[model samples]
Target chain A: MTTMPSFDQWMKAVQAEMEDALLRHLPATQQIPVRLHEAMHYAVLDGGKRVRPLLVHAAGALFDADARELQRAAAAVEMIHAYSLVHDDMPCMDDDALRRGKPTVHVQYDEACALLVGDALQSQAFDVLSSGNLPPERQLAMVRLLAQASGSLGMCGGQAIDLDSVGLQLTLEELERMHQLKTGALLRVSVLLGALAGKALNDDETAALDAYAAATGLAFQVVDDVLDATADSATLGKTAGKDAADNKPTYVSILGLEQSRALAEQLCVDAHRALQPFGEKARRLRELADLIVQRKA
Target chain B: MTTMPSFDQWMKAVQAEMEDALLRHLPATQQIPVRLHEAMHYAVLDGGKRVRPLLVHAAGALFDADARELQRAAAAVEMIHAYSLVHDDMPCMDDDALRRGKPTVHVQYDEACALLVGDALQSQAFDVLSSGNLPPERQLAMVRLLAQASGSLGMCGGQAIDLDSVGLQLTLEELERMHQLKTGALLRVSVLLGALAGKALNDDETAALDAYAAATGLAFQVVDDVLDATADSATLGKTAGKDAADNKPTYVSILGLEQSRALAEQLCVDAHRALQPFGEKARRLRELADLIVQRKA
Candidate 1:
């Protein structure tokens, strides 16, 4: 077998690719409704760790997916992530002034512009995913997966539950359900979208991928909770400890800091186990599980 | 030709169908993210003119579309319309307390809930449109059309322009472009989606439908401008004279009230002429052009 780039090298390469892909799909700053286009560009470009793109590329690697298709898929998922962050940072929501180590969209632009940026970015995501020369069924499938993941029963639902749960204690079960819907659903779909971008997988393999994504999703959130508790705002690139400050429940809130760390690690191990069916071909996926839990921010 | 429902009868039946279709696709309030679901229902159900749905069904009638397919298309468009209204009424946007004779989503619930409800409903629209047993290509077409119509170049883009244009004077050309993007694009797409719900259209027929929708869309806006200036809050169901009060440009702002009414009448004639290709089968679409321009509300 050909040698693969080290995880760091692969990640850096994919990040660069995502930058180009996202730029290509976004409306230019010079476009009509110039301010809106500028804000959309600002919200999406030159920021974020791009965890979703990394996951998409890693998963795409397993199926020998075309880089072009994966680029579109990666960009679409990242746009959704960026849009969510834009809205979540709004004064009506988290009311945060910072995101990705920069002023949040609402702080940089007005709140109305920020809202339009988020809404426009979402439409752009679907447009990018379904725009190219992919098979009709595959395109439709990807669109459906994304719509469902982003819909009421998924990310937005989680946001709603989070909104209601502020200042109130949530059980461990409730917290898990919230995270599963909010963060987990999108992450899982990122993997599935990557796979669907290339060759189809069998039932056994699909389930294995689902399991890997599910475990990894939980690990990512748990790690986020731990970081929010342990890291400073500078390191976190956002308002660290904002969850606890807002009286919002999170993995760390329910499981305690040390237990959350342990749970994240355990979840990482479970993610690795879920990749057994793919053997060595799943190395990128396996590495992601580790990175998700081990990263400082 | 078979006896058809009168315009009043046809519109009433389709409005009822849209209510059922919208409810069927929405997450039940008892669902996991109960608050979000509840807000989504509150924002969408039992409100609005259902104009987009009416346009969808009217256009579908010309194609002899399946009622089921038209139902899904109509509901999806209405969901989009509802979500836009929810966002438009937020404190950051128009900050209005009333919509469709009831408290706005943000007024009834909260700003955060309104945001989530709008977002969740947008996702639900795509989900509902893509979920059924329609042909894959047609489904993909409808999706792409909706995404394009709602994206940076479409409805949201128009909103951004409107946000930018408040208290500014716009030339007649600029005003038309703004309306075309903001409200006209969605209206045009509603017609296209309805027609797409049935059999495919040739280039000539498609062009004719596009023209028909364009004229109707503008006429609808012109009528809105007139109503906003002439009607009271109780009759309009929204705050009356909002455009004038907000200093936002409208047809009435650019043209004298007399000219605006003349424009609407001329556009209605154009709409009827565009339906010449469809002959008698285009009755519903022809009837809708009149309703849009003639409605007291």
Candidate 2:
């Protein structure tokens, strides 16, 4: 009998798969208007933890889906994540100079190019997601899902709330709602979309996976808050303490370090509990919840 | 027999239909993030001439397509157009203050809000387009078409080239190339997507419509150049002569005003010629080509 791969080994393999898919899917830098392509490449490649794509793969594997199609969906989600990061780091938004230990797109290139890069990346993500081997009906469902996750009712709406909430106190419920729309929307969709790349799941299975994803998504952000409060820039690969510095409300700010840590652990338990229905098929997702809560950075 | 509506009447009716569709399709401003929704509504409503949507309606009408589906497709295209205008008018790009005789999005709202508005609008466009009554196959095709027309190979690529070409003289070929990607792409897609909303056309009919659209799309830009050069800000509903002021290349700047006028007329003739097969069914399209050239603004 084959033993399951180590967590590190699984991560490395999925990361390589995602990297290859991204390189294959992105526009060639040699194309005309090379600067735009270059900026797009800079924004996406050799960066980030590939968390969303990994979630996509882990969830996709539950249904014994085609790896090739999962790679496409994974690449698409990563592109959307990258585009959001690029835009959020723009001068008018977060004005973050460093991301993933490199200068942000708007800092490396001009703001206009950064804006265009985000726009082009978004269009390309939908294009890639809706094409490939998925049946037309399934593809359409995926397109609608991604679109909803990315749009006003989801990420963007959450961002607007975040921007508005700066310097203002938010109740726990309000903060939860905001995070649900902002980061949670995309993370949950990543798992759902990954599963979608495979065979159809029963309603119960879909709900269980969604609950697992939703808990893990919030847990990820809660840990991010913990890291921001405890870690330094070198460890985080981005400016640490920017949340408090910007007067942005965070779990650490509201709940203090120990409580936030406790909350994150509780979320991890919830995430793992939700995956009980999937049995050992959800081992990777369970592992991800642990990693998210326990990571130092 | 019922008498066909005059050009004025047809324009008014389609404009009204598009307006109602946009209102029906856009996210209501009373939602949680009211400001973002308001900004989106402001960016889209009470704005520029509904040329693209009109093209969609005119093209879709050829095969007696469902009016409801045509409206959804038209509204989707218009949302894209509106979002582009909002971003293009941002401080990093054209930095225009006025559009359709009012402050541009970034001027009306803050730059951050404008940025989010544009991003949300784009996502919402894809969401609305891919949903609704259209078949999944047709919707997927529409999604792909819009994505291609909007991405690096199309509008954004053209805008990047335009950004780079400032203060530099470009050959007529280069100029046409930029316009083809920038303005021409969305315009052509408006016709094609509108056609796709209806019954599938024979190859000959498809080719003819494409040819007609290509000519008219270029003609629209040429006429825009003429208007930018000669019309006042009040009449044009945007800053006049800004292209020249910004040192951006235009047909009037490169080909001379008289030659540009002749080119526009020639394109209009070509547009009419391509529609010979459609006979009376092509009347609105043919008239639109004439109006595009002759409109003072």
Candidate 3:
């Protein structure tokens, strides 16, 4: 077996690629409405691990994907993620004051600006997908997939559940269902879109990628819950224990910390195993799966 | 010269067609989230003049268009309008309590539910466009046009301006620019989409329809400003004179009531004249344009 890269090295590579991809896809900040553009750049360019785009790019790399094509898809997914964050941090939602070690969009700008910024970014994702140089059929597929993943049936639905679960004791199954929709849906879409951008995949390849994405998505969330419980504010670059403080339902809350950690590891293993069909060709995807459950923040 | 139908008769026809179209497009509220679905139904089904949808249908008819095709386009435009109202009514934006003689979506349901409902409706509009039996190329064009019209360059951009313009004096030109983006973009899109649905139009037909939509759209807003100045809540079916109360910059504020009224009439004339090529076939559209500027509320 080829030696695996350290998680830090992998993350550094991912972060650089993400920044380049985002810069390339986004319109120059000076061109859009000043405040709206600023909020878009601020929300997206703020420091985060760039996990979603990484998953997209890494999954595409497994298939020897076109670099520019994958970049657009990666950037679009990140835009959607940023938009969700802006909306989620609003007073009507999670009411977060901090994100990625900086003030949340609403806190930094007015709430109306934050809301409009999110709306603009969300529309921008579809704009990117629709405007991309892909063939019409492929473009339609990408638009439909991303829309489904981002819309009420996916992340938004998950958010609704999360909002409802606040101050309520949610079972492990319920929390899992919520996360599957909220987080897993987009992650899965990212991988699927990346694979689609590369070449059409047969049923087996599609199934395997879906399984890998599903496992890694859940593992990613499991690790996130663990980090929330254990990481310090500086380490997390945000409010570390906010979930527990808000009495939010989380993997740790439902499964206990030890069990949650075990589940994450198992999920990572399953995610890596799902890539067996791709063999050594999917090295980056396998590495990503491994890194997902191991990261501290 | 052919005698024109009475304004009341034209309005009855548009209203009947609008009700039918709305009923046809929306699924049963029983299937989705109870509160959200109910709120959506309440917002759209509640009696309003259905101005946007009527414009879409009338514009389609101006080309001897298919009734069924026009209905779909009409429903799509109205759905977008409804979704915007739902979001605009949330606490973070306009914070209005009343809309169309009923409580605003956020007031009727929780703010979270209102937000999600708006999102669902927005997604649903695209869903209708893409999923209909329309040809793939037509569907793609429709989606692209609607996205641009509803997106940053369109209604949302106008809304951002409106948010920024509050408590500020905007010049007549600036107010026109804002309204053009805010209301005029969607209105123009409605006409363009109708032409598109009727099979691609020649350049002259397209140009004529665009001119018609542009004038009618601005006239629609001017009448809205006039109504806000002179009408009561009972006549308007929502808060009236709120613009003056809030010191919001509007056509009436910038040009005074007499000039605004004259401008509305001139716009209606220009809109009707743009449809000269369509002759008697454009009668419905011509009447709709006059009704828009002449309506009491």
State candidate 3's TM-score. 0.92
lDDT of 2 by residue, B1-297 (tens): 999889899889999888889999898999879999999999998777899999998888777778899899999999989999999999999999999999998899899999999999999999999896777777898888898899999889999999999999999999999999898989988998888898766799889988998899999999999999989999999999999999899999999999999999999999999999888887788888998999899
Give me the runs in candidate 3 sitting further than 4 Å from their true place.
Answer: A1-14, B1-33, B62-72
Candidate RMSDs in order: 1.2, 1.2, 3.2
Instruction: In angstroms, give how far residue A221 of model 2 lies from its true place.
Output: 0.7
Report the C-alpha lDDT of model 1 over A1-297, residue by residue, as the tens digit: 987789999999999989999999998889899999999999999998889999999898888899999999999989988999999999999999999899999999899999999999988898888786688877888899999999898899888888888888889988888888899999999999888887767898889989999999999998988888889999998888898889888888787888888898899999999999887878999998999988988
Q: Which 10 successive residues of model 2 chain A have the least lDDT summed?
A: A129-138
lDDT of 3 by residue, A1-297 (tens): 987666568668778877877776665667535667767788888468787878777778777778778888888888888888888888888888888889998999988888777777776776676666666666667777887787666787787778878999988888888899899999999999888887777899989999999999999999999999999988888888999999998999889999999999999899988999888878878888887887877
* Sliding window of 10 residues with minimal summed lDDT for model 3 chain A: A25-34
Model 3: pairs clashing at backbone N, Cα or C within 3 Å: none
Q: Tell how far residue B41 is off in model 2, in angstroms.
A: 0.4
Q: Candidate 3 lDDT, tens digit per residue, B1-297?
A: 986657677678878877877776665667433455566677778577888777777777665667777778778778888888888888888888998888898888888788776776676666566554456666677777887788777788888888889889998888888988889989998888777777767889989988998899999999999999988998888888889887789888889999999999999999989999999878778888878887887
lDDT of 3 at B133: 48
Clashing pairs in 1: none
Estimate the TM-score of every prediction. 0.98, 0.98, 0.92
Clashing pairs in 2: none
Stretches of model 1 off by over 4 angstroms after superposition: none
Candidates 1 and 3, the one with greater lDDT: 1
Better of 1 and 2 by DockQ: 1
